[model samples]
Target: MLSLTRRIREEILVIDRQTGEQIVIAPTAYRGNQVKIGIEASDRFKILRRELQGRERGPGPG
Candidate 1:
């Protein structure tokens, strides 16, 4: 499983290790603390967060 951040609206997504499919979970902004996980076909899904990338965090302030 891969953890990726949604680009446009700050949503969360995951990819199934067995299947080569993408699951567009509920947006983190709206869900707040809720999370959803499931599997579905690619044709039945729409990607609100098109671009996804990762970045490292800087050192915390003292």
Candidate 2:
């Protein structure tokens, strides 16, 4: 994965539409377009780690 370059800070919150529960996530640029999908802490960490690892390893085998 290529570097994002820009350092954008934003918060992600998961809320139960029916139950009215709220979960606030750390500020990360990777939250783009998926903020409404209800991302958990573990999921966020996995995504961030994978993203960083991919950037370091470059593209996958074709």
Candidate 3:
């Protein structure tokens, strides 16, 4: 995983070398210990938080 420190309104660009896919991440707001980010990506991509992904998949193989 890549870690970065960005201030509000700051933007970062990520590119997938093989597929030439691009994603933009920008920090929108900060409140207390939480932060709001904006992500720009193509519709072909699927993005989800870890918890949400788990819920979507339900329980793992028993």
TM-score of each: 0.28, 0.29, 0.76
* Two-way lDDT contest, 2 vs 3, winner: 3
Q: How well is each residue in 1-62 modelled by candidate 2, as lDDT tens digits?
A: 33333333444565769966666554343454542323455332444544476566668899
Model 3, span 2-51: residue lDDT tens: 89999987899889999989999999999998999999999988888867
Q: In candidate 3, which residue ranges exceed 4 Å CA deviation?
A: 57-62
Largest lDDT belongs to which candidate?
A: 3
Give all candidates' CA lDDT scores: 0.51, 0.49, 0.89
Question: Mind giving the per-residue lDDT tens digits that candidate 1 earns over 1-62?
Answer: 56665433454546778885666554433255655433334765543433443444579999
